[model samples]
Target: MYRRTRRAVVTSLLVSSVVCGGAVVLAPAAGAAVPAASCTVTPGPNDTYVTISGEGFTGPRKLNDGESTVDLAIGPDGTFLVKRFQKNVDYTVLAVNEDQNFIFVNCKKVGTAATPKPENPQNTAPAQPGSRRDIAQGRAAGNQAGTAAAAKSCTTKPVADKSGQQHSDAYWQAWTQAANRSFNRACHTN
Candidate 1:
């Protein structure tokens, strides 16, 4: 209930933001210069290097060691932090929600966020070149690129299940998550 309303609100706020993306694909903004895009994460729990450059944002901007929330020029004209988030240190990039709000960026820092994998308090290792994890990550990035495209142009088909109760709650829950992820991957940001 709460999430639904929040997503709706967030989505509305980011309407003018272009939500589209991958490792480092550069694309032209509607009427603006081609925006640089990428998220670089320097490994460390405290001083993780997190820089995001995109269309409306300032380029390759360097973040402080403990910057959780960053002010960015992300609006239509590309100047201002329309949203107010604390300047704490979190591993977030320029990624944003569907409505384009920066508050819901899905940056999953190693130790701070919830996860099932063994926690790494030290944000060690920049992505390796050709390791298994690296390969999987490449695949996931490619898949997410496709998914983001499909989702942006993809329309939601009506659920055909007559009972309505047959569908698992997980499906309902994940729908928004998928959309947000796709939006982040494709255009909103890193």
Candidate 2:
């Protein structure tokens, strides 16, 4: 009996409040929609490599390489680049943002063949002999090129401390480590 009376009182109060314009309603603000994420896969120099670029990812994101589905962090400018990704092998890049919005980019032409072709297809045009030393030098040059690209991508502004003062040595050390990690990821040096 007590429970029934309490329920009736609560219902009457709610109805009266609404009728007397005492009720408050909430609504979402207009134009608060988030921008959509997008991604692209493009062929790199001489079709030897592929690059996966993404934009509009506003937060930490995951990259699904189709096969491996590894999670990769996106950059601060709502963009990320996977440079020098090897070509001649099928790859579907999927970028998923924190909100679960995703965009898939297919590298159909870049790596469609089951059996990969040679990196240099100028077999008929050139028969120039090369020594082991030349091969080593070529590898070194390629590494340097990759490092250069990674350096460009890894450049970042120094972060101010929470108190808006100069950062401590420990903070700088952590920042440098993070930058190094980003460089390694971009250049595949690690």
Q: Which candidate ranks first by lDDT, i.e. highest?
A: 2
Please, what are the lDDT tens digits per residue for candidate 2 over residues 74-183?
A: 77877877864654444443433212343333433433354455465543342222534334433443445445557666544223234543434444444445545545
Q: Tens digits of per-residue lDDT for model 1 on 103-181? A: 2333333333322345463434434444554444444544554465656554432222325333334343344455446
For model 2, the superposed segments whose C-alpha errors exceed 4 Å read: 1-31, 88-98, 103-190
Cα distance off (Å), candidate 2, residue 127: 15
TM-scores, one per candidate:
0.21, 0.35
In model 2, which residue pairs have backbone atoms overlapping below 3 Å? none
Cα displacement (angstroms), candidate 1, residue 7, comes to 5.8
